[model samples]
Target: MPTAKRPPKPPPKPYHHGNLRETLLVAADAVLAERGAQGLTLRDVAKAAGVSHAAPYHHFASLNDLLAAVAERAFGLLAQALEQAATEPDTAERMLKINDAYVACALARPAQFRLMFGPLLARKHDYPEFKVAAERAFGVVLTAACAHDPERGPELALTGWSLAHGLSNLLIDGALEGLPIPVGPGEGLARQLAVRALGVTGAAA
Candidate 1:
């Protein structure tokens, strides 16, 4: 007449109900950092996130969708950094600030930075809202370029955008590392040279 033993309980699932989208995005970034873009996969992200295989699909319809989201977030951050840099008392200073900010943000977020400038997201060029946000961010440089020379605003804007964008990409690719230079130094030097060339002054460093 031995007593029967109680049944053992099943272990609890790992995922919480909230924040799954953010979790998936973070996992995607980690994978991107570790493996670059080629090896990224939704199932792999879901596994990294400690969620069910179907969980990531709920957040991102496809791997491209996830990459697009990552690019969007990176763009948002780039926009904020530009805006923050644009808070100078004068136009010349504002432009330099925004330029510097853009370079800094790229260095800080190289993975997202790469995907933003990379060719994958180029397929979504038809998306108006994406174009709009991109334009607004570009406008920061445009405004700055105009400040440098109103008559050459359009040309100068393109120049500034290309320079800033190029500088950031180079830094992210490690082409500019260990050169006895700082992130803001080259930008500051460029500003000084521009000011000298354009006969302008009064930008906050």
Candidate 2:
């Protein structure tokens, strides 16, 4: 008689329970915050999650996919922040709040800030959700700018974006502290520059 054969053991699971996709996303953000976007790797994310190297692939096809997910969430939050800022009744106050909100959000999450705007995610457009999220975030500022200056809304929005984006970069790099500007704070400087560019002499008053 032949010896009885035993069934093979079941393959290990990445996680025994709970959502693996959410776990990978959380792990990816930790790697991003620790290593920065340029140095991030899917394998490192898997390690952060205590999973196999190939585990990230189950949720994200590549590093870009992971980045897209991260950026999308960041942008969504940014949109909400700006929307809340836009609720100020006074126009000048609204502008100040908008700039404040933008910079505050960036300051609160400097790691995600870099990844969201850096060239590391050149393929971000490949992800529809990411693009939609980005547009919504930008639309908030654009709406505020347009409401402030209807005739040159598009141009005003671009100018405001240029100042805000540049200001955020400077603030992140710790390069704005010594700047010789009349404004008291980085966000104030952003509003002043934006107001000047928007031709709002009264607002600057």
Candidate 3:
């Protein structure tokens, strides 16, 4: 006689995380990593989280909402990296360290970095949390710059930030490869460029 058909597998147990909001955020990050912001979507995030497509809607209203959350986390991490570099007492060294940290963060998570600064997610008014986190991260550089030059703190901060941001984009976009600099490690080359361009001295190799 033919064996009876096997019972259907349980419906995936409805994918449960202790905190669904946080679960969605984690899943969103993974999706952002594999696919840039343009490719990210609420349905995709929900699928990655192993929940129904509607599940993400419970935590996020739209793709922008999810992106804002992910960008907030990215800014927080960038802030921590800058803060760690701020521990250096020397002004030039501190600035260089902060710049290096910024570049390192970009290199470590290019997709997340791009999402953090991308036009869609950078709308400060629309995403207060993203704005706040970004401001806090920027404050690290501001503080370092002020410590270096009391007379031109704001200007110095702007300059430092511009340089770092430009370098990060170039590195991420693979534009640095066209430079005439010797073919050293990417991070080393990046750090060297930041130090030299910023006139920072006493930076560790």
Two-way TM-score contest, 1 vs 3, winner:
3
Distance from true position, residue 116, model 3, in Å? 0.9
Give the lDDT ranking, best first. Answer: 3, 2, 1
Predicted candidate 1 versus true structure: per-residue lDDT over 122-163, tens digit per residue: 765744455566667888777777766788988867766777
Model 1 regions more than 4 Å off? 7-16, 126-129, 147-149, 177-205
CA shift of 175, model 2, Å: 2.1
RMSD for all candidates, in order, please.
Answer: 3.6, 4.6, 3.6
TM-score of each: 0.79, 0.83, 0.87
* Model 3: per-residue Cα lDDT over 84-192, one tens digit each: 9999988888888888888889889999998888885547789888889999999999999889878887887887788878878887898868678666666676567
Best of the two (1, 2) by TM-score: 2
Runs of candidate 2 with Cα error greater than 4 angstroms are: 1-15, 120-122, 179-183, 199-205
For candidate 2, the clash count comes to 0
Give every collision pair in model 2.
Answer: none
lDDT of 2 by residue, 46-110 (tens): 89988878877887888888888988888889989999988876665676677777888887889
**Candidate 3 regions with alpha-carbon error over 4 angstroms:** 1-16, 178-183, 203-205
